[model samples]
Target: MSSIRLFILSSFDLLGPMHGHRLRIEAENRHVSLWTEISVGAVYGAMARLAEEGYLRQIGEEKDGKRPVKQIFEITEEGRRLLAELRRSGLTEIWYKHDPFDLALVRLDPASAAELPALLQARLKALEERLAEADRINAWAAPYIGVTKRAALKHGQHRLRGEIAYLREVLDDIDAIVAEVAAGKV
Candidate 1:
């Protein structure tokens, strides 16, 4: 389901009359439970917040045998306009991807590049520490994870160790290449 803060409000505008209970039922019918305290808070909070923003309003009320009255809510013209603006802006299609190592490389100034060996060495040292920490974790979780996940977690743990070793090799090769180039012998 869409998680944009406006998702529920927009759906109510599209679908006819909808209250929190009806919304929960509809969402549950689609195999999604929308009744958690967090969800209830967000939904009622969004509805009230939007109403204050002049996008929605409490229009009617219904009562169930064992509960307080349910206040039905509906979207206003302002809410429709807001949704239209969002649709026009294509907010749903936007995304971002980031890579930490590539980001550092991109931000490297010439001074930093000249000092790259020390920086990379520091990074490699940190990685070694992390690898050791991961090994400790693996040891601690070995019995429980082995029993629960069988060969899967163990196989994945081995692969993780292999990858970390491979990263060490790559870092070493990078250091050598950098040294060679700095010496004008490459």
Candidate 2:
């Protein structure tokens, strides 16, 4: 199963029966987008797909005055079993052999070398911005989350800092390469 499905199932397990809207709100309240690729807009579609798959079923409908009726969904026995299996086995698995930057770097040519510094600088800027956001998340989440969770956030920030440092070194190397090419020495 995809991580998104697993996350949605886990959400139902944590929050109990909820409509799509409530699930989206819960995801936002938990700041899921800060850590995962899942978006708030994807929740409703995932709910529909899971419902169609029999993993989730409509328990009832809720109407909030002027708003349209909302379908309440709950996890089924199959879903519970799958969730347990995923938790037991999936939690131990790690996959990290994917990075767009790796591909770009591999394909870079001397003719296009001038663009590398700018691209790397842009990525450095973005990573720095993400580090700032992580700080904001840490400040707010520290009071509400446990020590282990706070550590996980710090871990991400630490990893970003390391990447930023490495990228700076690479930019320095690129500067040397640019100068050498300009002087026809490379």
Candidate 3:
């Protein structure tokens, strides 16, 4: 199941009937991009697709001021059922992606030894910055978000911290690593 589909369905289920623009605004307000695959701008297309699939139905159209008419939508019973299935699958699934950095490290060439250290340092810095940003967002959102969202924020921070720690260890052993690579042992 797609996270975007889940997000769109859940938003409709919880927030009642809303137009695509409103849904997009809600997604942006919730900072869904930070943790989920849902793209704020894609909500319109997803809503249209869901309506076509019978998961959502267009209720009416409304025009506010000079703006064009907006088609409002509400979730169907099928959407509710689909949301439950999506939640179940999402909660039960475990995913781990292989980082390309691992492959590059394993294939490190002695000639690139000088570059590896700087590259690793840059990566470490980026991860550290991400962790800091996560912390800031968590702090800002704590008052408005529930425990589940807070947990997701923490999860991201934890992952960043783990990577930062690993990078530190690699930096500490940089000399040995370069030597091993130079000897064609890595």
Candidate 4:
């Protein structure tokens, strides 16, 4: 599913009529980038495309002081239908994206095996940093956000923790892994 499309349609459905600029601001304010694949810069383009596709319709235009006229838009019945479909698919789908690290692990040569520990250590460090940041964001947003958003934040944290634990286990067995790789048994 297109996250941008879902976000745009849902925002319109929930917030009434809004211009592209307002949508972009709302996306940023909601920290969509942190939780979803939506890019803040893509909001305007997506809005334009949604209008072209008849999912959205321009209702009016507003001018703020010297700024150019902004075209306000609202979701159509088609958009609402699309939004419902996206929500259903998104909630029901079990998406497990493949990580390149798994490929690298299976394809590791004896020489690369020796270097795996350092590389894994670096990745672990980065994941730790990300977890710390997630914690801070959760603490800051907990009072303002609903349970669903808090659950999303916790989901991200849990994934990071899982990876961190896996890395530590691998690191603990690095010597054995290197031996296996050297023996061409891995």
Candidate 5:
């Protein structure tokens, strides 16, 4: 299932009949780009694809002054069914991957140990900033959202905290490893 497809169908389901331009705006307002690989241009392309696939039906078109006309769309019954399926899959699926960090760490050059600590320290600094942002979001959202939603927000923060802790340990180990490499002892 394509995330862009799911996002388009879900947006129509929630926002009622809307044009692609409006959908793009709402998607940005909701911060969909932050967590997903979907681009702003992809929204229009997904809308076209969804329409081609019979999931979305264009109700009509509207034009304002000299601007290009906008095609208004609504979800079909099949779209609703697909949306439910996608939502269920999203909740139940665990997407595991070997991250780039692991690959880079494994490929680190012992001869370049002098440059490695600064690189890792830069990554550590980034992780720390991410952790801080996650904490801020969790704190800010806790009061207004439901228990489950709040827990979900905290889950992100918790993961960041764990990553930060792990990175700290790695940073500490980096110096020792660099020393050992410089001494030709390992």
Candidate 6:
């Protein structure tokens, strides 16, 4: 239903038509980085959306006494098709995929010394936008802080800080490279 459909289905593809608890565990086992709190809501929403789109079908019963029933899901034929397409679609050649990081490095191969500064500037601008977005999310989640935030505020802040640091390091590296290239060193 959304861009996250791939992750949602892949999570299911790995776990099989399991209910929430099982899927959560499987996602964690597969990617310890996934916080169940954040991922559960996302995966659940994605699953429901996919079901409405006929990409998935209920497969089993999961009644837990007084707790809400969890409906198991199975990949529909359409889901399989969609998954395959998502997996291989980048290869068709009509248009090549250019992820942000790839594009940054790819352009470095042919860019002139003058162009390097501008390109690095553009990349830094993009990084700034991302950091700004992360900051906004962290700020909004501040009220929930450690308790109600699905992901801990500290964790989110730390993750954002890591990203910011990585971006800054890249920026520094590019600046040094540009200086070297301008001086006929690299």
Tens-place lDDT digits, model 1, residues 96-136: 34648766655555445577767777876776675676567
Candidate 6 local lDDT, 1-186, one digit each (tens): 233576666666766787766765655654424322345446677778889998888988899899988888988889888877765652342432445865555445434766766766776677677667767766665664456454534555565566567766766787677777666654
Q: Per-prediction RMSD in angstroms?
A: 11.1, 2.9, 1.9, 1.6, 2.8, 11.1
The most accurate candidate by lDDT is 4
Candidate 4, 39-120: lDDT as tens digits: 8999999999999999999999999999999999999999999999999988988878999988888789987887888898
Question: Each model's TM-score, in the order given?
Answer: 0.45, 0.84, 0.89, 0.92, 0.82, 0.45
Q: Is candidate 1 or candidate 6 better by lDDT?
A: 6
Off by over 4 Å in 5: 33-41, 141-149, 179-186
lDDT of each: 0.62, 0.82, 0.91, 0.91, 0.82, 0.64
The residue pairs that clash in candidate 6, if any, are none
Question: In model 6, how large is the Cα lDDT of residue 38?
Answer: 40
lDDT of 3 by residue, 37-126 (tens): 677899888888999999999899999999999998999999999999999998988857899999999998889987888999999988
Clashing pairs in 3: none
* Ranked candidates, highest lDDT first: 4, 3, 2, 5, 6, 1
Which residue pairs in candidate 4 collide?
A: none
Model 5: lowest-lDDT 10 consecutive positions: 29-38
Model 3 stretches astray by more than 4 angstroms = none
Please provide, for model 2 over 114-148, each residue's C-alpha lDDT reduced to its tens digit, 9 standing for 90 to 100.
Answer: 77788888999999999999999899889999887
For model 1, what is the error of residue 178's alpha carbon versus the real structure, in angstroms, after optimal superposition? 15
lDDT of 3 at 5: 95
- TM-score winner among the candidates? 4
TM-score of 3: 0.89
Model 6 collision count = 0
